[model samples]
Each structure stands twice: as C-alpha cells, then as structure tokens.
Target: MLSAVPRFAKIAAVVVLAAAASLATFDIADARRAGSSGFGSRGMRTFDTPAITRTAPTQAAPIDRTMTPRPQQQPAAQPPLGAQQRPGFFGGFGGSMIGGLIAGGLLGMMLGHGFGGGFGFLGLLLQIGLIMLAISFAMRFFANRQRTQYAGPGASYNNSAMNNANASPRPSFSIPSIGGGTAASQKARQANDEIGLQQADLDRFEHLLTEIQSAYGAEDYATLRRLTTPEAMSYLAEEFGENATHGVRNSVSDVRLLQGDIAEAWREGDSEYATLAMRYSSIDAVVDRATGKLVDGDDRNPSETTELWTFVRKPGSDWVLSAIQGTGTH
Candidate 1:
C-alpha cells in the first residue's frame, strides 16, 4: 500500500495537467469566431428558435447574452369555480391501511422482529408480497371510481357528437405548386415575403458581411459601432479585449459570400428583423501581437464558415448587425 501511494499521486497529477491543457486549447478555438455561441438580441424573438435554411440546416445556437427581456409564460389553467377537488392517493382509507402496514413493519424492525413480527426472512418476503397485492387492489378501486364518476347520461351523447363531427368529410382546396425552384429557394422566398425583403436589402447584407469582417480584423471600433447595434458591438469588443490580453490579434480579410438565404424575417412593432443564413469564405488567422508572427490558422488560404446573422432596422434606417450565431464548422 505504501509503494502504491506514489503511483496514485503521479497518475492524479498527470490527469490534472492533461485537463488543463485541453481547456487552454478549447479557449483558443472558441475565440476564433464570435466567442463560440450566439450573443446579442433579436428583439422579442431573442429566445425563439430561427427557421433552418440552406446555408444553416442545423439548429443555430441559442443567444446566451442579450439585453432583451424573455417573454413571460401564460399561467396554468385553474379548476372550475365551485367544483370539488379530487382527493389524492394518500387521502383515502386504502392509503391509511398501507401507511399502517409500513409503520408496523418499521416498528417490528426496531423491536428485533426482522420486519415480520419475529417470523424472520421468509415472513419478510411474505409481507412484501401482501403489500404489493394491497397496492394493486387500491389502484383498481380508484380507477373504477373515476370511471364511474364520468360515465353519466350526457357522456354517450357527447361522444357520439364528437364522432359525427370527426366522421364528416371536410372540403379541401388545392394550392398551385411553385414551378422549377429548389425547396431552399421556395422557403427563402416565403421568409422574404414575410418582411418584404428587397434585392437591395440582400445586396446590402452581403456588403455588410465583408465590411464587418474587415472592420473587426483592423480593430476599427468606429466602423464596427456604425455597422452593429450597441449590444452586438459590446460582445465583439469583449472578444477583441480578450485577444489583446492573450498577446494575440485576429486577422480577417477577403470575405466573400458563397451562398446565403433568408432564414427568417419578421416585424415586431416598428422594428423589422431579418435573420440570414450565410456561407462565406474569409482569410482568418491569429498572430502574435508583439512580433506580428502567425500563431494559429491559415492566413494564405481563405476558410469557409456558415453562420446565421440577424439584422435589424427601423422605418427609414439602414439595417445593422443585431446577432451572430454559428452553425458549427460547416
């Protein structure tokens, strides 16, 4: 045992060191794009899930940080006024008998009766069987009582009426199929129609994607503030601050949109929101701040990334970045 102590201590130290290294690696990877998960607000739909699109078929990560308040849930329905509340299982005579049996068994054990009134293990088993039987009988009795209560004169009439309503054939209308477009395009068109997104709006979205990447890479706080909401700017600024503290800087450039479509668009009061799924290619890399030497990522080859970016605008204002959600590596 004395010799084994050193071996155990060595093993524990190795495990701890391994865990710490893994965490450090994860932290570096997370800082690559918008700090891993989603952040910023989407107005009233901040917590709501966005629709899946061609660019982002998988579910987008939920926004973990937002200034928007969560919608309140409706209260549960209450029982009808003056209606008698149903008694719980333990409120009846059957429950009293079971309770007494359990108490008696506990008392028997305390008095050295082996939970069977001094009759030993076989008696204990017999008592358990009897208790199970009592429980079965109680359940059946309660079930029958509930059934009888609802089996009134009006019950048959109500059931018949429901059957008749369901049996009747309902008239159907045929919707003309949209001709010659992929399912993704159809879905995108439908989403765009919801908020009246024009071609100009889409062109602006592509432009902003490139502009934001360029601004972020350059650490141009002014341009970032102009292009994004205050809430979004805060998160981006926080990521930048973290990179500076770690003695590194993120370099992103040559951003080009490969594929993109509107995931969802809606209007809440005066503010119009559009969540777009975009697959874009950019030269993203991290470099040592002091020497400007490459620390991580390929600076030469532009890497592709799929993300859901939500933009918000008022009546006559240009759309601004409101949220950024990663759809994993793909």
Candidate 2:
C-alpha cells in the first residue's frame, strides 16, 4: 500500500507539471479595445438633422415640421435707418440752414461790415450769428408748414420693415414646428429640440444600450440582429467579421450610462426616431481567439465615452438601435 501511494503521488506531480507547461506555452494575443467595443454613430445625427428626412427630426427646430409649435419670429427690429426713416422738417431745414449761412457770409463780404471794417474778425462772427438766427426762424416756419401738411391724427410713424428681422431665436424646448416647409427652411432653426423624453423612455434606452454592447462583445449576432435594425446589424456583422479575420474578439462588461440626453425625437411617417447623447462607461477587453489572451482593452479599467445613438421604432413597436453618432450632435 505504501509503494502504491508513492506511485500515485508521482503520477499526480507529473500531471500538474504538464498542465503548468501547457499553460505557459499557450499563445496570448494582444488586447485592442479600450475597455469597450468603441463608440457607435451610424444612423442620423442631431442639431443638424435638417435636410436629412430619413432620420428623426430635431425638436424646436424652426426648420423641420414636427408636432411642436413653430416659434414665432422675434419682433421686427428697427432698421439702421430709423432716423433717416422719420420725415424731415418741412422745406429741408438742413438745406435752409446751409443756404442762409452761405448767403449771409457773402452779403457780409460785399457790405464790408465784417472782416474788412467795423467789428473786424469779431464783426464777422456777429454777422454769422445773425445769419444763423435767421435760419432758425426759417426752420421754425418750415416746421410749422410740415406739421400742418401732415395733420390728420396723432403723429404716426409707418415703418416698412415692421416685421422683418432676418431671423429670430428658435426654441430649444419641445415645441413642434408648424408644417413641413422646404427642407432648407429648417436649416436655420434653433439649436435645441423640444425633447419631451420621459423617464420610462430613458430607462428603456439605457437598458438597451448596455444590452446591445454586451451582445456585440459576446459575438452574439442573433441578439444583435434582434436588437438592431437590419442595416445596423449588417454593419455590426461586418465589424465582427473584420475582427474575426484578425483573430480578435471584444469582451465587454460592466456597462453603465454616465449620462444621457435627447437631441431630438419626432415621428417620420409612422415610425418614431429618438436621437440620444449618451455618456457611458464600460470595462472591455479584446482577446485573441487562439490563445484567449488579451489583445487590447483593459478589462479592469473603465472607459468613458460620449456617443450619439439613434433609436427607431414603428408605432406600437419596440425601439431598436438604428445609428451611432458623435457626441453633442444636437
């Protein structure tokens, strides 16, 4: 029995040694993902969604025709020519003032009542002052004529551009636009969308965001197909295929949404699209298919990213990821 025990111990030791050697010899690839699969931005965009009708429209956009109210244009600004627009004093006060000054100067020169005699330079000044006084009287007389000529009711100023300032501030809140005007009209819309996003909607989207990332990392194409649109799935598949060709796979874990905001939400026909800006963190790592060694990404470290994701859904249907975009698109 003692001898058999020694033999058994030797066998176990050899097995352990072989296992360690195999582990040491196993190939380890490099990790490439920075703790995540990377940011997505495939679908439409925010802030400038104008002209792109296939995607959801921005809210409060004076441009896109949404359900929200069109923001009224700002009050017409007084043109730069406000002073010019007002009617001048009758008979041209300016013209009379200049004419009288010049005539008096000429008369003074001819009469030798100023610089050439009497008051000298001072006399010239007095003569000009008298001319100005005469001009004032003339101005008053003409002003009276103007007042009488236009006497009807109270003084009324009519401005042609009473309602024409190039453009006004657009509401960024959830107001819908009036109608689908020309696509170009929506370009200069306000910077914000009237995103009436509900808490429920956010929560659902957050969940979907995390799930989709996890599924993609797992190479679970079926789940990806179900959660994303066919177009998105195709892109994802291409990405996966490329990764596979390189003998790499991303392992995503611990996905959390740091923050999220809606760029816009609107119905395009029967389908609704909501473009969201999401700041999220995740632990991701790329592994070598042959060695199960990290090829990229830090599995222990968290990566923070801000991405714009657009989700689309038909009425009475579930929302699926349609596109990914850069952050702050709105």
Candidate 3:
C-alpha cells in the first residue's frame, strides 16, 4: 500500500506539474493578446505534438459562409511590419533563466521526492514545491522576454549607439614596451610610473572583469547583460545559444589578468573613452549537455589558455568588454 501510494503520488505530481505549466503558458498567451505586441512580436508557433498539431489550425478563418455574407466578412487584423513568429516554449526556454531554474529545481526535487524520506508526505510537498518553482521561473522568463522585446529606452539599442559613436576604426594606441626577453618583449610594456587610473575607475573595471569571469564560469548570461556591452553580450548569447543546440559548453576555468595597459584615454563631447588592453589565461572546456561528460577533441582536464581583451570606458561609467582574442597553450 505504501509503495502504491508513492507511485500514485508520483503520477499525481507529474499531472499537477503539467497542469501548472499549461496554466502558465495560457497566461502568457492571454498576456500577449492583451498587449499591443504579442510574443516578442512573433505570433503563435507550430506545435510539435502530433495530436495538438492535427487539431490546431495553421491560420484562423471564419467558419460561417452563408450566415455571414462573404462581402460582409471582416478581414483579419495584420501583424505589425517585420514581425516574426515566436518559437515554442522549449525554444524560448532552452537558453534562458527559466530553463536553468526548471532543470535545477526539478532535478533536485525529483531526487528528494523519489528516493529520500521513503516517499512520504514530505516527498509530496517537495513535488508541489518543484511545480510552483517551475511556474515562477516560467513567469519570470516570460516577463524578461517581454522586457527585452518591448521595453522603452532599450539598453541594447542605447549601447549600440554608444558603440558606434565611441568605437574606433583602428587601434587607437599601442602599449609601451615591457622590458624582457623575446616572449615578454612581445607583450605590451608598462610604464615605470602609474598609468593615471582613478580609484573609482579601477574599482569599476575590476568589478566588471570579475563579473565577466563569474558569468563565463557559470554560463549565466542574464548577469552578463549588465557586465558586458551590447556587442559582447550579443556574442556571448550567440555562443551560448549554439552551445545549447550543439550540446557542448565552452567553459573558462582560470582567468589570470597578467598585465593591463590603458592604451588610450580621451574624451568626446559628453562621454569619456578609454581603451585598455588586458592579458589573461583560461581553461576552455567542452562537455556534453545531457551527460555532462567531456567530449572528444577537447581536453578531459582544464587546459591552459591566454586571452587579450580590450575594454572601453566612459566617464563615471561602466566598463564594457569591447574585444577579445584568445589562444590556447597546449
């Protein structure tokens, strides 16, 4: 009876979780209907499920022909210009916060509920908590997607403007010669005296580097939004998206900031611009998405790698990752 109870509870929990997910999806659809923009400016997506796809109409059309004269029939409202159909929940969730939270919470809760506590009342509570967590994650995800899609005074667009105005066509300045042998001489040299970095500037710059390192390590892209410029963020997001699809993650292990040089510092009308050259090392890892196992061609262990990053800064402003070129040392 006890075993049967647990099995029944497990089935019930799955059904409840599925219902919650459906409810959340329905809420999202309703929200889109209510808004001027729907589903990130994309309409409903195709269903993969054969059962659902068979019944779901590809396009909406009036069923009544004789009752309502064809001439009197109203044409369907058209979507705004340049709008693309949005992907399904799986597509939107894969590289997003909701996906991560759902993956982590459900796995943990399943672990606890399935085996721990001998599948008692506590197990049922865990399952419920897991479902609620998943719903919350989905809600937050939909909200974030909406914000990114529709928020006014868009950060990425603003950053794009700034980048266009601030970024130089060519390398603005070169680093002074660092005294050493062949390898050291190849690196940019640091001047004997201080490079005239303000305390606040240094602090902010370090903070940004740290944030980038953390984000790179954990593959948490949401946090990277604030730490990196739009260009860098877009690049990372693309890499992450590819990784999710390909089932391989490029992980950075150790980030060693060897020498940093303020290659150039100047001011435009309102914003200040500085170009910094930074050298660092990391361990790039590629692993399977399902098994979390290292794939062939990539080192099983963390490998030594080097990178030179160029950052741009504005007055009393945030440090933005501008460029990066890296190489691995096998």
Q: Of the pair 2 and 3, which is ahead by lDDT?
A: 2
Per residue, candidate 1 scores C-alpha lDDT tens digits across 287-324 of 99899899999889999998889999998899999999
Q: How close is candidate 2 to the true structure, as a TM-score?
A: 0.44
Residue 163 shift from truth in candidate 2, angstroms: 24
Highest TM-score against the true fold, candidate: 1
- Arrange candidates by TM-score, descending: 1, 2, 3
Question: What lDDT does each candidate get?
Answer: 0.74, 0.56, 0.48
The count of residue-pair clashes in candidate 3 stands at: 2
When 2 and 3 are scored with TM-score, the better candidate is: 2
Task: List, residue by residue over 96-214, the lDDT tens digit for candidate 2.
Answer: 65655465545445444322245555555455455545555766677788787766543442221222222332322221211122332243233234434454565678789899999
Which residue pairs overlap in candidate 3's backbone? 177-189, 178-189
TM-score of each: 0.58, 0.44, 0.37
TM-score of 1: 0.58
lDDT of 3 at 241: 90
